[model samples]
Target: MHRITALAAATITLAFGLGTGAATATATATDDAARVAPAAFSCSPGNFCMYSDWNGGGTRCQWPDERKANTADNCSFIQRGENVRSVWNATGHRVQYYTGTNYNSRVGSTPSGQGGNLQGSYQIRSFKPQ
Candidate 1:
């Protein structure tokens, strides 16, 4: 009777461990509403352009009239999954400038010209530091 009971207990214990082994595994994070804009966007930051709109200094990356075109000449940008501390790896882009409109019209024209340049101060949006 004792031998039979010991063997039965050991079998039950092994079965329990095998049955719930996956429970100890960690759960992964899932964001259903997340945006898939990684590796960068189509917004360009034209090289060697004027930025008189801010009444600021020269050598600005804002370009003449570039609003949104993938201009990776002088600078580059990167997107991240979430925001976090630790600047070990790049989490976001150090945008020389941003554009909400297409720069097709600004072609072959100066930035200070009529509708050829970007006007007003743009609100800089913050992203997670990857």
Candidate 2:
């Protein structure tokens, strides 16, 4: 009787341990989902826009036509000499971005209907269809 009781208790402990582990994994997954940051911009169709802040916040500059050189003079954020930290490519073609004026320094490209945050050095100075 003593041995049987011990076995029952051990089995219950093991079952509870496994259940706790499963609960912990589910909690971790929920936390990860909550930590993901969602895109924060509303880009219009047929245009390309840049944001002064990451994930598309802050001032924005948009153009219907591809810009070989982003003057950014008319843009509130770029007018202050701040580079683009994020971009939304709403056009139907791939967009090549540059870190230098007149598309001199190629940085990266964004596919149609996509957007993302940029590296610190990849501040977009110009963009055109690829």
Candidate 3:
């Protein structure tokens, strides 16, 4: 009977300790919320437009509005001086493309993205292809 009582007490203590640890962890994450700043941007919409403007000093070109390229150029020109280019698929999935806006302007590589961090890796999920 004495052993059973001690075991029960220890179990309660252990559970309480674990609960306190979780509370501490959550508190720490909450405290650092503000310090966790947004990653610095080296690319922008204009970077994409540079290709639109001329494909790297070539000539302002227009992207086709097809399933393979919905609003892909769907929206207006990448924006002036903006380098990070995010476009939406037909269903409106926002994808940040790479710096060079070639036909396969796949994200994850660019002059500005020479040394990208985890945040630099962009997604390329299928959209309406627009």
Q: Which stretches of candidate 2 lie over 4 Å from their true place?
A: 1-39
Candidate 2 per-residue C-alpha lDDT over 1-130 given as tens digits, one digit per residue, 9 for 90 to 100: 9999999999999898787985654454234212221237557777787888888888878887866586464677766778788887777778998877788888899877667788744467778889
| All candidates: CA RMSD (Å) | 18.9, 10.3, 13.7
Q: Candidate 1 vs candidate 2: which has greater lDDT?
A: 2
Arranged by lDDT with the best first, the candidates are 2, 3, 1
User: What are the lDDT scores of the predictions, listed in order?
Assistant: 0.28, 0.72, 0.32
* CA RMSD (A), model 3: 13.7
- Per-residue lDDT over 36-66 for candidate 1, one digit per residue giving the tens place of the 0 to 100 score: 2111111122222233222322223333322
Span of 10 residues, lowest total lDDT, candidate 1: 82-91
Candidate 3 lDDT, 1-130, residue by residue in tens: 9999999999999898788984654454334212221122212221222122211322222222222232234333333332322321112122234334443555442222121232313332212222
| Cα error of candidate 1 at position 47, Å | 38
Candidate 3 residue-wise lDDT at 66: 23
lDDT of 1 at 56: 27
Q: Hey, what RMSD does candidate 2 come out at?
A: 10.3
